[model samples]
Target: MSARQPHELLLAARPVEILGVALSPVEYSGVRVMTLTMIDQVHKRPDGTARRNFNEHRARLVMGEDFFELNQPNEIRALGFSRPQGGTPAAVLLLTEAGYSMLVKSFTDDLAWDVQRLLVKSYFAKPAPATDPLASLPPEQRALIALMVDNASIKAEQAAQSQALAAQAEVQAEQGAAITAVGQRVGDLADTMLMLARPAGAESIVHIRERINKLHGLPSRIIDEVLRQSPIAPKPAGMVKHSREEARGGSYAVYWIKDVSAVFARFSGECTRITATQVTHPYIDGRFKLLPARDRP
Candidate 1:
C-alpha cells in the first residue's frame, strides 16, 4: 500500500484543530457522520450530553434516517473511533447532519454557533467523489459498509420465511374446518338411512314404542305420552288382531307400523308447542295438569 501524502495527513487531522477538540471521522451509507462521543467532544459539551438529548427526543427521531446504532464490537470498531475507557461499548450511535442539528437545537451560545458552522462546512460537508469512493475511504470504513449490506440481506431472508410459515398455517386451518363439516354431513346421512329401513308389519303399541326409541333416541316421556293418548280403536286399514297375555281376556288391537308415522307427527307437534310455551307436561306423575294462565298454548 502507498503511504498517505503530507497534504492528505493534514486533511485527516484538520477536524481536531477546526472544532477545538479531537473528533473522529465516522461515515455510514456513503455519508460522513459524528458519533455521540465525537459530537460531545467537538461541541465542548459534557460527556453523554448528546446521548441524553437523543433519549429525550427519541420518540420523534426516525431510525436509519436520523441515526444508526452498531451493537456489535466488530461493527463499532469498523468506524475506527476510540473505544470507551472501561471496555468496548454495547452500542455506538452515529448521528447524521440533520440529527446533529436537532440534538443541539437548545444550545444558542456563541461557542455552539461557531462550532456548528465549522463542523458542518469542514467535516460533514466533505464527501468522496462517486467515481472512486472506496479509494478515498480508509479500510475500516469500507469493511463497515460491506457488513451493513450483509446484515440487511439476512433480515430480508428471515422475513420471507416467516411469511411462508404463516401462509402454510392458514391453509392447514382451512383444511381442518372442511374435514369437520364433511364428517358431520356423513353422520346425518347415516342417521336418516337407519330411520327409513324399518320392518314391514303391524306392530303392538309396546313394539312400536321400542322401534321409535331405536330410531330417534327420544326422551322417554315423549314416547310414553304418544302411546297413552293415541286412539285405542286403531284405523280399520291399519289395525291387526292380536292376543296378548297382559290384555283383558287375552285380546288387543295392534297398529300397522307404516300408519304409526302420522300419530308420531301429530303428537310431536303438540310436544313442540308445549316446549315453546314453557308449560309442564300434560301427564306428569300419571296425572293430567291444566295449562297455566301464563302459557300462551
Candidate 2:
C-alpha cells in the first residue's frame, strides 16, 4: 500500500505482538544519558508537523535503537524480535495471546487507561459489569491497573454526563429555533469511510461516538462522517480504528492501536519507564575534555 498521510496512517496501525524486544541504554557519542524525555520533538514544526527528515536521528530511530519499554526491568524485555511472519494484522483492541503477553510485560499507568477506553467501547465484551477487566494482571501490577481503570471509568462517565447536559441545554436553546429532529438510518462501514474521503482534521478512535452524538437530522454515522471530514476533526495521537470485524469472540469490533509510546507520552509526558543515560564522562586524562562542554561558567 502507498504511504498514508500521517492523519490517515493511524488507520493502518494494527495490533501485533512484540517479540525478542529488550530495553537497553543509549550511547550518545559514548556518553550514557539515562533520562528519557519521552515526548521530546526532534524535528516537529511550529504547526505540529513532524518533518519527514531521514537523517541521522530519524535514520537511527527507524533502525530501532530503543523501542518504547513500558516499565523498568533492566537490560531485559526482548524488543529485538524477528520480523513477524505475516503482515501484522492491524492491531485490534484484542491482541493475539503472544502479542498481549508481551504487551502486559510493559504495562504502566498509561496503558491501563488505554485498556479501559477499549473495553468501554467494547462494552459488550467487558469481563464483568462492575468488575475490573485487568483482574488477570499479576498481583504486583493488578492494583495499579485496577486503580487506573477505576479513575478512568469515573472520568469517562462524568464526561458522558457533561455531554448529555450540554446537549440538553442545546436542545432547550434551539427549541425556539424549530430544529427538526432526525431519526436513525443505516449504512455499512465503507460508506462511513467515504464521508472522510477528504478529511478535515485528524480524528482518533475515541471521539467517534461523541462526534456522532451531536448531529440531529440524519443517521449518527452520517454526522460522524461529516464531522470527521470537517476542518475541526481532531487528530488523535495514539489509537486507530479499522473496519468492523470479529474480535475477542465478538463481532463489529475494529479498534486497533500501535503506538502506546505516543499515547502515554502525549497524555502524561514521557511515557517510557526504561531508558538509560548515555554515558557522560568528562576526560580520559590523556584526552582531557574529549567532548565539548555543553555548559561553561
Candidate 3:
C-alpha cells in the first residue's frame, strides 16, 4: 500500500501494549513505523542506541521507502510529541519494519529475536480496527439505534452514580494520605533549616543541596548543574565516605558548602518566578501518550 502522510496516520492509530510497554502507535501508509526512541526502549537498548545504529549504517539503507525523517516541529508534534523544553530536536527518525530488521542485524540476543518476531507478527501486521456496524445504516435505523444507546447510557449513568457513592470512603482515605505526605514534606523542610544553621564548613553536594533547596527552592538537579558548571563555584575539597548502595566504590567527592551556597543563591535568585512546565516526548513509557485526532495540535 502507498504510505499515507504522518497526519493521516495520526487519525487511525491507537495505543497498543507489547512486553508490558505501552507503545504510542504510528502507522505510515498501511504499515506501522516506530521512532528510534521507541525502538531503543522496546529492545531494552540505551536511549539513542537505535539512532546510532541507523547513523552507522545509513549508507546501506534506503530513504523514504525504508525510513522517513521528520525535522519540522509541527510534523513531529503531529505524532504526539510535545515541543522540547530547551530546544528543537535535530530530526526524528521513523523506521519501517524493513528498516528495523536491517538496523538490528547485529542484535543477536534471544530477547532481540523474540521482540522482532512479535513486532512482525503482532505489531506491524495487526489488523485495523473494525468499522462501526451502524455507520452505513439508513437514517431511520440510525435514529432507532441512537435511541437504544441513549437508554442504555442512562442505565449505565445510574449504576456509575451508585458506584461513586460507594467509593467516597476510599477517596477520603486517599485525601488523608495526601495530608500525611504534606506533613512529611514539612519535616524535610525543617531538616533543611537545621542544616542551614550549622557552621558554613565543607559538606557533600548531597548535604549542601538540602540547604540550597531550602534557601532557593530550586530542584536538586538544577542546583547541582549550576554549581558544577559555574566558573565562580569552587572545586571539591576532597573525596568523602558514601555509605549509599547507589554510590560506586562507596565514596564520592564533597565540596565546601560556603562556595556552593553563594553560587546557588545567585543563580536561583535570577529566576525569581519559576513557572512549573512539562515538555514530554513519545517513549515506550506513557509520559507522552498518543493523543486522539481531536486532541492533537
Candidate 4:
C-alpha cells in the first residue's frame, strides 16, 4: 500500500492554537468545504449579578503550497500546519528552509498581537461589504458607522489645524523676542554715547560737542547744550585767537577763550578753550557772545 500523504494526515488531526486562535485546514475530495466557528465564553463576577463575556470567531481558508521546510516551525503553526519534521512529506516541496525560518521569526517576534487583533476587529466589524449576503443590518449599526467615519475625519482636520496654529504662535513669539532685543541694544548704545559726551573740567565745549555728534548722531546744537551743562576751563595765554571778522563767508575761525572768574581761575590762571564760527544757525535760539576781555586786576 502507498504511504499516506502529509496533507491527508494533517486533515485528520484536530485544530491547534498558533498565536491565540485555533485554526485548521482541511482538503476535500470533490466539494469545497468552508467552515466558520464562533466561540463565546462568559465568566461570572463575584457578585454573580454581572458577567464578563467574550466572543471569538475564526474562518478557515484552504490554500496550496508546493513544499515545506523545517527551520521555522512557528510560521507553519500559524498557518495551521504542523512542523515540517513532524509530518511526512509530499512529492512537491512548498517553501525553502530559509524562507520558513524567516516567516516563523516574523510571526513569533515581530508581529504585535494587540495590533493584529485591532486590525482584525476593524476589518470584520467596522466595514460593511458591498455584497454582504446577510439579510439586513439594524438602523443603529448604520448610524454608528456613519458617526465613526465623520468623527475620524473631524479629528484629523482638528489635529492639522492645531499643529499649524502652534507653529504660527512659535514664530510670532520668536519675532517678538528679537524686536525686544534690538530695542534694548539701541537704548544701551544711546546711554553709552551720553556717558562719553559728558564734559569734564578744562574740556573744550566745542570738542565735547563734536564727539557727541560723532558718537550719538546728535545734532550739533544738542551736543553744545550737553557740553554747556558740563564743566570747562579757561583758554591758555599765548594761544592764537581768531576774530569773528575772519569768520565771515564759508570759513570758520577757531579761537581760544579765557575764563578769569570764580573757582577755575582760583586754581589755575588759564585753560585752553576752542571757539568755532557758526556756518549754520544753531538749533537753539541763543546769541553766541565772546567773553569780555578779562578786566585788568
lDDT (0-100) at residue 104 of candidate 3?
Answer: 93
Once fitted onto the true fold, the runs of candidate 2 whose alpha carbons sit more than 4 angstroms away are: 1-140, 178-297
- Better model by TM-score, 1 or 4? 1
lDDT of all the models against the reference? 0.63, 0.32, 0.69, 0.37
**Model 3 worst lDDT run, 10 consecutive residues:** 281-290
- Residue 282 lDDT in model 4? 30
Cα misplacement distance, residue 256 of candidate 4 (Å): 15
lDDT of candidate 4 over 179-218, digit per residue (tens): 9999999978654433222223333446544543443333
User: Which scores greater on TM-score, model 2 or model 4?
Assistant: 4
Compute each candidate's TM-score over C-alphas: 0.37, 0.15, 0.39, 0.24
lDDT of 1 by residue, 138-226 (tens): 99998999899899999999999999999999999999999999999997765443322223676666776667655544345556555
Q: Which candidate tops TM-score?
A: 3
The candidate 4 region of ten consecutive residues with least summed lDDT is 49-58
Candidate 3: regions farther than 4 A off: 1-7, 11-14, 83-87, 128-297
Residues 1-297, model 3: lDDT tens digits: 255654445434566667877787777655678888888888899987998999999988898778887777876665555534755566777789899999999889998998888788877776778998888899999999899999999999999998998799789999999999999999786544433222347777777777766664445666566667655567776655445557643555667777776765455434422223222222111122122223323
TM for candidate 2 is 0.15
